[model samples]
Target: GKGSHSNDVGAIQADLPVPSDVLIYYYEVTVKDAGERGVIAVGFADVHFRLSRQPGWEPNSYGYHADDGNKFHNSGKGEEYGPPFVQGDTVGAGIHLENREIFFTKNGKKLGAAFQNVKATLFPTIGLHSQNEHVEINFGAKPFQFDIEGMIAEEREQRQLAVLRSRIPAHACHDIVCSYLKHYGYAETLLSFDQGAYTEQVAKDEETPQAFGLEDRKRVRNMLFEGDVEGVRQLLIGKQPQLAQLQEDPLAVGGSGSGHKGAPGEPFGDAFFHLSVQQFIELLRQDKIGEAVEHARSSLSTFQGRSHQHDQHLQDVLALLAYKSPGQSPVGQFMSTAQREKVADIINTAMLESSATASASGSGSGSGTSAGAGGG
Candidate 1:
């Protein structure tokens, strides 16, 4: 019915049918005029054929009064709440079926939780106790003024993160991955990983082995590839002194390297032996015969009594001292680019394996794992 001032006391209701008791139902009423008495009410009411001048004038109806900003329910009891509205004001009513709560909003701003413990099926209803009162009702055919979907997505994301947190502590995982990425010179990838996985605050808070820093350790490997045997020796002895003893006693390697506690396995005798041979080759290549002889006496002699392969390799390195250019010698493969790469890989493998072990034991020195694994 079209409510009018001529009706004396007019009441109107929408013909649009909505679910009475499932999900959330929201409706808005815009007051075009406050009427001669400034009295307008909008709310929910039962469906059976009973109508009253005001919505809550009947049983099982809940109405929010626009004039006094009060709620009227159960025929008489009224409570002051919400914001009073006049002409050109919009009021919204939302009923949450799951929570059984009724709430109101004024001009898209929530007035607050108004009623709790609500029940029963109802329909959108409006009533006017004075002439000229006019209101328009909208039954959620348009967008909501609030970010309800965004709120739901945020809640879902929080739940997922909570599940991930139950499986792994976020900070510890971030530290491990970041450390591994840094070890391998994956700067751009590490940057993206950090930005996505952690905030600036967390990345800045992590600590590591400063003496054997990833860059410093990687530098030693690079020097071996470049045949800068002296640089590799100084770096290892300074930043990773334990590496020198990696083959000395085997048990001496049992203690932690870089302050990480773990039982060491497989003495890196080959790594040190390769490094020693590379130094001897570089010395001979420099054509400093006297120093080459001294280097062989000091370093190469130690391998003479070891494996037959080691003895043969030592004799080959010493023979390089007699050549004007070792690259043209019969055993020139020793000076080939491939040989340097192989030696670098051997040393890198030793370091990566040691770091992975320490990491598994909870005290990684950040050397990373194998080439395909971690890369330091």
Candidate 2:
């Protein structure tokens, strides 16, 4: 059926509204026949849009007419836009959610944005007027004729470049990079960065009281990264002898081990737990199942039911024993160097937090006191 009079236009809408959560949404329509008057319309409209009127004849609707090559919005009057679309022409309509703009394409060529400030839950709508007008809609079920992916990529790159171009304090940037390198056990890189980028800052850092024992922390971090869990444990305990005392209490070791309690040896309890787990994993890697089981029983068994994360991690680690080739197991990620690095990072953070607490308390107690004086 076709329109009999000027206002007798027929339009169809999608079952659901255009998704608003994404950055952009686009659809295409292929005109099967331009019909007698070639009065076809493709665009978006709100729920209140009338099917008996051209899509852009009323409020909260937008459309591009095939006959006049004009864009219309909120009125029957249209403005000059793209070329007229006809049979076999693939026309596209897209909504840019972030920018609140609507754009159209004709035969895979974009005609630029036509509407802005769109703020409604609109549906993809198409209108047909006059006899024999027909169109088939494609809601991204097939490849898009327009280069939408390229457009998205270009937008993302532009945003990233904008962020990189923003200015920040030079010292702040240096400190952030330095802290990152130290936290990740990149000792060589940190040294090169300090010597190369901020030679003067390195000298100033050496004179600061907080810089004391930085080398020891780096050594412990390196040991952990080298898969020497016992070495890290020994080094940490040697530096803070109270860590050995805290390890005797299972509750202290498992309870809130990840937090800095401001108590001597309390923070190290969590670090010790991580080291024990790593030690068990190392024994398993060496094919010493008996030693690994004994280690888990003596060290990790106490951590059970203490925390959900610990329990789940312990379960995953134990599952590795079931596979003859543990590297092929579902929990095989725990067997990689990346796992060791992750554990090292946790231990390094605990050490840094504990040291910061010691430094803060030491300065509060007296001016002449050393940072480690509060650790005892």
lDDT (CA) per prediction? 0.64, 0.77
| TM-score, structure 1 vs. true | 0.40
| Model 1: lowest-lDDT 10 consecutive positions | 367-376
Candidate 2 lDDT, tens digit per residue, 1-376?
Answer: 5466867788898989988788888999999999899999999999998888777777999999999989999887899999999999999999999899999999888899999999989999999998988899988788889977547644653454345335455577699999999999999999999878876554333211332154665676568667788888777776666567555665553256544344555556667667778999999888999999898888789778877887898898889889999987888998987688678767766766655555444442332323343222
The Cα error of candidate 1 at residue 17, in Å, is 5.0
TM-score of 2: 0.47
| The candidate that achieves the highest lDDT relative to the unseen native structure | 2
lDDT of 1 by residue, 51-158 (tens): 545766667778888768888787655788877888988888777776777778888687877778877667788877776777877765766564333333333434
Question: TM-scores of the models, in the given order?
Answer: 0.40, 0.47
RMSD to the native, candidate 1?
26.4
